[model samples]
Target: MRAAVVGAGPAGMVAADRLASGGAEVVVLEATGAVGGRTRSVLLGPGHRLDTGASWLAGFYSEALAYCSGLAMLRRDVTGTPQLVVGGRRYPAPFEPGVLARSPLLGPTEKLRFARWVAGVLARRRRPHVGPPRRADADRADRIDADTAIREAVGAAAAEYVLRPAFETMVFADLADLSAAFVEGWIRAAFDGRYRVPAEGMDAPWRRLAARLEVRCGVEVTEVRPQGPGGGVVVEPVGTFDAAVVAVPAPVAARIVPPGVPGRPAWLGELRHAPHVLAYAARPHPDPPPASDVHPAGAGRHRVGSVALYPGGDGRVPVGMQGATVSAEGWWSDELLAAGLDDRALAAALWDEGRRLEPGLFGLEEATVLHVARHPHAVPVFGPGHLARLAAWSPCPPVALAGDWTCYPCVEGAVRSGRRAAEVLLTAGR
Candidate 1:
């Protein structure tokens, strides 16, 4: 059998790899100049690379990571101490066992509420109730969206600390739009395993996967029409195949696939992508406390929110700038200049320690800025009545759907959906 995979993102790559490995002739069509879609690494300098997208990879991604490992895409360590600033005070990362146990992020009552909520979710998982399949042929074991957000399901408190301030920033979306059930599962998974990143860059794993397959990059699949009954998909700009995995972004898939295939939710399309400006600057300040000892950032913290530094051993210093709290208004740059952090002092820090490791962090005589403004609709936002839409949408003939947007907005969800779609197509082909 022949299969055409659209998009060349992680999900599409997974689908293509699976189909090719299964003895099907696979052709991957990607719209972008390069593959990897949203997860591609950005070239910061002449030889320096930074994972501009999908920087974090958790150990919970067993299936995807294992596939990459087989392809020999080495995994890299990205662990570092996370410093949280609250009210101008710095604390260690709060998600840690110790921080969670001692920090004020969760009040006693809120913590008890969280415990009860978690217990309820665990109880449901233990019993394992299955809803009607989204597709007639979908697996009976598939779980549908579970009503589980702190704001909508519980109250304001859970939304205050856990959902709004923390998870929203972490996931790069507002809590109200995300699935509470999904978050619950993610938290559970984290407790069960550790999170890591790929060694070379974020896209290294997918790149390795594509290396073993026939990938046609920069080819946008303009249309996907039925060749005939059981004739498979006719993909424009790439010819036809016996089957096709429409694994691109939901909007892109929606455009290619015939109607009835689930597109992203309107609210998801309405979702706003917050702007993240990562500035690599130099400061003569001493090394801050370790993340293991600091508290999570909250209101009144350093104007720079969500800053985590990872010191690369072997004489290289790399610190990640993740704070997006206040707008371009009153930033630390002004304060630093006002407080008089001499340009020379800061330059010494950047060139001596920072440049040796993250060359991207050096030579900041002027403000070195990299701004990332993702489309609001870029990531799927699991919103009200999301399950209804998922249950209603159908794929165009021979063009099954996958991606994080289908189920949840995470890499694991994207892979699971892609694999599920592949299985569906492969079964039909057989």
Candidate 2:
């Protein structure tokens, strides 16, 4: 069997790998000059490289972890307590043990209410899985927005000061725009408390996988259409294959897959995405660095949404220098994109925000901007009804869809979607 995989992102790469392993000849086509898609790493300086995109790997990312099994990994020590900056004051992250009891961010009555709400969620917690939730309770949870659920369960203060910031920092979208099921799944999955990154870069695993496949970079696939009854043909320098997986983003997929394809759902064009702008900078820091990670409560009030400081001697920066990545708030990123600001202007704006927000955090006054990464479709927003839409769609043989949008919006989701797509075609005997 001959298979064609479009896009070289994690989903496409994994799909190609699976098709080849299943005794099919596969060819992977990428639009850009490089692979990895949103998992890209950029060179900052002579000996400095930074992952401008998906940088952290959670313990629950089973598929992504398996892909990076033999590669060198660096575990980020969570022993250092993460800080939540609110109203110019720092408090322990809400997830930390004993934080709810001691944090001044909540009143005595509010703390009790928040604790009860959390206990309820924990009681219903189950192992996180890709795609829509299978259980009845989890499926119900997907019908409500996270913000509404939190506000109704606890109170406005807990939703504002505790949950919203943390969730937004992770997904780059407002809690009001997300589903409660997504939040619950994240809580269960991240409970393991193991976070790591590839020792080389976030893109290392994809690069490793691509090396074993017939990947053609800088090859754009304009269209994927059905050929005859059981096969598909990729246009723009056509190639016919028994099976094909379109693993690009939802919007891109809508454009590439013309009408008449059996599996092309109308909701594909309606999927929402969060925009992101990340500024990478480095500065000399003789003194100890502040918290390695900081999530700003009420991120809209600040220009920068979150900050992640690289550990000392991480090799991403020179000795005695600290590296950091500052992410612009979701709304702010939209403004920047709309204004058509260049990388330099964007970096300058983020630098100014970092200096104003946390003067002592990374010595921003002395920092030099290395690179600015912009993602128009940084993350797929899993809002209410998203899961139901996914569950209702059925795959047609030989023409399958794969992306994080098909599952959850994370590395594991992307990998799992690819595997499922390949399994569909392989099982059909295409």
lDDT of 2 by residue, 1-430 (tens): 7888998888999999998999989999898898899888877666577887888888778899999999888786564345778877878766654877888888898898887877777777756566776643447878999889888888888887878766686778888998888887786665667888887788889999888899898988888887876545654555788778999888888888886787888788889789889888787666545436777775245557777776447755656678877888778888888878887788878877876666555544577646889888889999988887887775666679999999879888899988988889899874
- On TM-score, the candidate that comes out on top is 2
Clashes per model (N, Cα, C within 3 A)? 20, 0
Provide TM-scores for the models. 0.69, 0.93
Candidate 1 error regions (>4 Å): 43-47, 70-84, 92-101, 105-108, 111-158, 260-305, 314-378, 385-397
Report the Cα lDDT for residue 190, model 2: 56
Q: What is the model-wide C-alpha lDDT for candidate 1?
A: 0.53
250 Cα displacement, candidate 2 (Å): 0.7
Q: Give the CA lDDT, 0 to 100, for residue 30 in model 1.
A: 87
Put down candidate 1 lDDT per residue, 311-365, tens digits, no spaces: 3221112343211111111232333334443544533422343233222232444
